[model samples]
Target: MERLSLTLALGDYEHTRDLATGQVPVQGVSLNVLTLAPEEAFFRFTFFREWEVSEMSMGKYVSLRSQEDKGITAIPVFPSRVFRQSMIYVREGGKIDRPEQLKGKRIGIPEWAQTAVIYSRGYLTHQAKVPLGSVEWVQAGVNQAGRVEKVKPKLPEGVRLRPEPQHSLNDMLLAGDIDAVLSARPPRGFGSGIRRLFPDYEAVEAAYFRETGIFPIMHVIVIKTDVLERHPWLAMSFYKAFEEAKRRSVERLSDITASHAPLAWLAPYTERMKNLFGEDFWPYGLEKNRTTLQAFVDFAFEQGVCHRRLELEELFPKQVLTSFKV
Candidate 1:
């Protein structure tokens, strides 16, 4: 029997860093691990940017998405914690009390970010009950000032919409051009910027329609269907390995934290990660997190991120799911 090779795509996140640094172990695997881009995981046998054509060329790819694109199997790799996306942030000295104060504040975010646009429109305006059209949205990217548009669902009548600006968001926020940012969790590198801008920073759950609908989906790991068919034992082995890794990850949380410093949202991040992983954070296939992943996929379809609702069974490795338990 030939040794297997698994190619993975990871994001620029801390947990991924832990995986790369060997702070976390894969456990019980001897396959060659190759790192690929966030998007190119689907293309096969493209080792180190070298393209090889074959039926099993791509091997197995695990990346981030609310769900896998059509024809691929997406396993819930990790449970993601939701955070705030706002326009104005108050530093050491500011008078902003709650969401209501956000009225008339200028906000900056990615124009095409579905999460930001949808959540702001649905959750913030409808649930928070902020004045309609109160947020002055400005479009900004890393290069060149951009344009803004209204993405919120329902707004109060007769509010004046300002001209969205073009500027780098961090630059604008630091320069006092934008009042807050409506985005996902701030990454570690940006932690200092967040602390400097909002020294009184706190993670507030946005008002969302959890009562009747699904929450937003962030990322999932997708496997090809054929791969599952060919390597029956591999899926179970991977799942078991990941489940153990997740367990180890939680058990050694203290060590992980000690090794990594200045993690402002450490407590909450760990708690959420633990919740998602449950007994294990790195479970490969069948974990309770699959339920949450299904809900997310359904919601993504409803919210238009995914074109249609994907069946959990169809999205996961069926062979592995039927056999694995944690």
Candidate 2:
């Protein structure tokens, strides 16, 4: 039987490398994989649908899904998961030394709908007890000028967000124009005089996980709706292949005989993560990730990234949601 041919655009990550390199194969599908930077892949696929399958920003996906845009549907495969507590940046000698101090401050973000910013704002709102409306929001590129939001979000009442296309967030933060910056990528000024709001972020993130049980999701794998309609089983095939690839990456991370990653004490760190997050530290699928997914959708809605709240069940194809047990 001839296999279904598909193209997948994804970031270069250890977890998905096997699948991208063809070591792992999607059942009944021939994949032509393109490895690109996350920003490039997301922009191309989100705007033009350049590929049949792509890694998408969770905030952007939920925004589109909530608006009932049926251009694409996702499998439960998550290519990126990150904790955003460390993503917040504050200027040296800034007044905002604590989370509560964020009130009435100007915070710069790459986009209001950015996945990382959504999670960061969620933490501020729910965990830090800071009301979203209390702070003035500034939108701009992280390090460069003229960046614009990719999707239109329904801003919640009292939430003030304005775009500064002429200046980057990095420049604004350094110049004291914005009190702080929330972003996934560090600003260009991060090392010089800017520092994380939580300087000891690893402990803070671990504590947050213990309290909230959310290892915030950054990206999800999406397939064009038309392709899924023609081949309904494609979802499960893709899910299974991604699962296997992730499993291998986990195994490599846990291997103590030799280093699978360049970092020192990787094995010990992996073990620590397992102890904190359970054996399947980095998990895929709806049920396994329900807490994180549910929290994200709720945040997306409250932050105006999503037009309405999205249910966990509505996020992925049903095929990837369940499987036949042997």
Candidate 3:
């Protein structure tokens, strides 16, 4: 067997860095996965970029932006473990214990983030029965609060929107500026802040689709469509490897948890991911996720975030997904 050169987009978290950089040899497979945020993925995808990368990112937005482009393939894997806990953050100094108490309070979230803005908000409105418009939204960023691509049509009314570009939600929360901050995972070092807010704060189990009846999109692994055409077997091999990685990650979580002690919050998150990505959450390629994500595209289109709807074949490489499904 020949070793194929592959590039994966690794995130900035310490554990991911450890997986990407510190350990070169893992169970006989070596990946030169580069780390970058969603904003940087597009620039990194350029073929001539200095970074040696075969695959880059195609975030959920790609379903809208890359509708016609055909050179690359993207697979939406489980989001970086950090994202799993984003937006589900601690509410400090408030009488808000249950989801209902969140009403009329100020909520701080990252700017222009589609995941938390649309999906998380929708979860609160639809399942929790909270009146969406009643809460005030502060978009925290630098110089500018990120833009909301499109508001889902079904979001509850009376939601007041506030734009805060001067500081981050973490800073705002600690300073007593905001009632709650929405984060993917807990901010890097705010366990004390979380402790301050809710001494016994346990995570709230929430899923956008299950709660709101809409497919929520997040991160996934993408391979170039042409790559699959040339090497069909590689697709299955890659899928199987990640599945095993998930399994290895679960069975030996102590090793993973111990090795990546930097991510204290990740301890609980790993179990939820194991449940979702376990059998119910199959990396059976993209089909299962697609069925769910496409509905999101439809919702986005209906909400007017996207001008047009995307067909699965148009957005994804036709060859790979079809084979994976069959």
Candidate 4:
């Protein structure tokens, strides 16, 4: 039988490189992979369904799923996971010296429903004791103007978010129009009178992970529901391929003979991560990531990114939920 032909659009990630380069095959599928930037792939795929399979923001996916949009379904293959403590930026010599000071301050975000902002806001509310309504939120692009939220979020009661399409968050934060900014990418003026809210963010993020067993997930692999309906086996094939690719990347990270990563002391860092998280630190699959996934659903709902709370099962298709054991 001829293999099913499919197209996938996603960011050029180190872990997914093998799959993208065709070193790893998706079981019986002939994948035409388009390695685009995450933003481009997300925008095109979310709005236009540009590809049969793509990487989608968890926040946006949860929002869409909550609204009962059945156009797309996901596998448990997460392409991106990041801790957002380091994503927050504050002005130097500003009143907001600490996370607690974020209360009653103005914060800029690229979008209200942005995955990074959702996780950052969740951290503020749960860890920093700052309520979502405590501060005003300004929305705009990170470095350019006229960016808007792709999804319409039902703002929770007492939440106040204003869109400023005329100016970028980078400019606003530099001009002090916004007290701080929560962004995945650092603003252009990051070092020019701007600094991370947590100067020692690595330690803070590690501690946060320890305190709450939630290593925040940013993006999930999704396929058009119609495509899945026609080819139900595609989900497991994609999941298994992604898992093998990630496993190879992890093995390369642990190699001490020669550095797979450019960073010095990568082996030690990988070991540290292994100690903090288990051997499969960057894990794929439902059970290993349930804590983070469940927390994200709760956060997205509470923050109004999702109109209503969503069960974990609702996010992924049943085919990829479990694999047959040998």
List TM-score per model, in order: 0.55, 0.98, 0.59, 0.98
lDDT of the candidates, in the order given: 0.45, 0.92, 0.50, 0.91
The full ranking of all candidates by lDDT, starting with the best, is 2, 4, 3, 1
Residue 40 lDDT (model 2): 93
lDDT of 1 by residue, 1-326 (tens): 54555544544444344444445444433433445543343233323323211111111211112334334554545423333334334332445556566678876555423343444544446456665456676655522355342122222246343434545666666667666655443422244443333333333332232342333444444444466466555555555544455555555454544644476656567677555435443444444445545554443444344433455665555665666248
lDDT of 3 by residue, 1-326 (tens): 55666566645543233345533233324467666775456445543343322333233344335344555555444444222323556544446666666777777766333544445554555556656567777766422344332222222235455666556677677666777766554554366554333333223333443443333455555566576567555555554455555544444444543645556656566667546555443343566666556655554443334445666555544444654343
Best by lDDT: 2
Give candidate 1 misplaced runs (Cα > 4 Å).
11-30, 34-71, 79-82, 85-96, 100-106, 111-127, 130-139, 142-166, 172-179, 185-217, 224-234, 254-287, 290-295, 298-302, 309-314, 320-326
Candidates 2 and 3 compared by TM-score, better number = 2
lDDT-superior candidate, 2 or 4: 2
Q: TM-score for model 4?
A: 0.98
Q: Candidate 4: deviation at residue 284, Å?
A: 0.8
> Higher-TM-score candidate among 1 and 4?
4
lDDT pick, better of 1 and 2: 2
54-168 per-residue lDDT for model 2 (tens digits): 9999989999999999899988888888889999999987777889899888999999999999999999999899899999999999999999999998999999999999999
Which TM-score value belongs to model 1? 0.55
lDDT of 4 by residue, 24-109 (tens): 99998998999888888888888899779999998889899989998999899888999999999989878777898999999999
